[model samples]
Target: MPVSSPQIINMGCRLNLAEGESIRALLAGRDTIVINSCAVTNEAVKQTRQAIRRARREKPDAELVVTGCAAQIDPASFAAMPEVNRVIGNAEKLKSEAWEAYDAVLVQDIMAVRETAPHLAASFSTHARAFVEVQNGCDHRCTFCAIPYGRGNSRSVPAGAVIDRVAALAANHGEVVLTGVDLTSYGPDLPGSPSLGQLVERILHHVPQLRRLRLSSLDGVEIDDRLFALLTQEPRLQPHVHLSLQAGDDMVLKRMKRRHGRAESVALVERLRAARPEIAIGADLIAGFPTEDEAMFANTRALIDDCDIVHAHIFPYSPRAGTPAARMPQVEPAIVKARAARLREAAAARRSRWLQSLIGSAQQVLVERPGDRGHAGNFAEVRVPPSETGEIVTVTIKAVQEGKLIA
Candidate 1:
């Protein structure tokens, strides 16, 4: 019989991606196969099931364990699956003792938990850059969200712990990204209540050797002055911002319980660009939410231009059960899909223009793969001459082909 090393199938956000790396390190040298599932949407749950089945088929003799948000919210459903041998919750997945036990389910009350462990600092992963999770869970109760239930209330890792992790990872990885369920909501739960800005400033000041620092999706409202200043002025930080702007219409935003209005979001981006002309803008927009009329959708569509969103994440509104928005009147499925497509089309056009503008300009590309492929500081993929992997090099943009820059 061939010995099987643990195989981790990860799905979902950057935070989950980072956690998967930690899990992979934890379960090494074992004949177990793990599915690190996501539960952000109904579609995400469906994909988790698909991943589990596929994992089992590929490794029939290995013990199949399921963990992450999907398994945390409904462990019994995953436990009922014939292919699954064990199901662990989000909290238990990190604990060494949880892996030692052979219980059918090791899920605990996530809501009752208060703090998050700095798991990434201890793990070694083979990737172009490292992702360090500074926070986990959410406090906000958005009407269309089930993440809070799955992840529990917002909790932050201490700043000292985070700095230590980054300091260690920065020594090896060329770049490091800060990720969380609610990244901007960091610091409120910790002692002395140091803001995310404070943390970033401290990390930069303490770890001067860190080449590049990137941030995952951000809530536009939470970009305070300290954070905003660093975003505009800091050379070490990447020049890309992905906002969690779900909807562009004020009424739709009100219904979704979002904190920032459309104008506020537009203004924030405007200020960012005014300070730094080269920064790229990315946003997440949902189409055809409950009670959204055509005019409301038009507001959202027009926003793609207003914000100059070069990278867009368009999700056709799918109602998740037990959410407030799910209980309201939903738009037709066809209409939802159509609106989403239009958003993507608009974003692509904006991105094309933005990329074309970069022609003849110099960009620092972080080499990722074996050949000439790498991502720029603004997160644009570029092709350069064959360079050593994990090295950052300056390249002049030559042309755009198939949505990538060639140099």
Candidate 2:
């Protein structure tokens, strides 16, 4: 019988998606199954458990292993599951030896990991674009976040390693997106304290063949002046800025232990628009948090318009175990769901208007596998004429259909 190749089931953020590709390369030819789990929210953990059981039922004969943030934080619980044969930590998952002859449970103290494993840099996701894990972990202790404990402290992959990886990947892919747990918190842990902007500068400067570069979610407060200049002036960098703006009200932000408030987020968007009008704004907003009154939710709802957010990731408050938000006065579950729906409606309207605005303009879109669809530099989804896959083409927008721009 022909041996089946190993499979990697990814769950969670783009960082995990990127790491999953790396893990795939590592476990090549092995007849095992790996579930890259997430633990950002209570819902995420529950979903991870569901994925474990589902994977087990699909491939009952294969050895099932679990890894990623969920497994890193609580390995014993996953290992005890009847479906799982092995459990590994986030750090160990990247190393080659861990997969050779895995132990029943190999989770370690994540907080003690100071250096990023350099070998996991070059990973492939798609022919059109590639996601690179430039940074990992989080040092911030936001009241609602359990990710810090799961991912450990902030650590950066050195500039040289990252640039080398990008150069190699750029030879094939048209776009490269930098991803991390706390992306904006990059470089502080590195020698000479190279800022994320400096790293971008180096990547763009060195790898001239790279067509486009994009950044994952960022904390607005952490963006330095150098990064600001790049966002406003650099044409190679994609024109979409997705901020980690959790709340819009001052009191709510303070309660959540977030660094920036509503005004700061609005002002940052204003400044970005002033510098580059075509730049699209994206943000992550929690609908209802602990002690969030109707007025506070109103402020958050207004942020959709105030920030001109064209891309929004609206998450309802789901308290995770061991998080400070879980201990705080909780908002009613029904209220949280209602507010989340309102935020989504507001965001959809904003995005619809933004897409409509592009109806008359011409945009350079990078065609993906389907050849008829791709995203512009501003991250606007566009329906284009048939073109070569992985090739960049110019399209004249004629109208807006549903959520995509027709060309």
Off by over 4 Å in 2: 1-3, 121-125
Give the per-residue lDDT digits (tens) of candidate 1, residues 1-407.
77557888888888887888788778878888889898888889999999999988988889999999999989999999999999999998987788999899999999998988646645545677889999999999999998887899999989888889999988778899999998999998888998899999999999999999999999988999999999999999999999999998999999999998999988999999999988899999999899999899999999999998998989888888789999999999999888999889988999999989999999999888775899999999999999987899999999999999999
For all candidates, the clash counts are 0, 0
lDDT of 2 by residue, 42-98 (tens): 788999999999988988899999999999888989989999999989988988998
Per-candidate TM-scores read: 0.98, 0.97
lDDT of each: 0.90, 0.90
Provide the lDDT at 321 for model 1: 77
TM-score of 1: 0.98
The local lDDT score (0 to 100) that residue 34 gets in candidate 2 is 94
10 residues in a row with least lDDT, candidate 1: 117-126
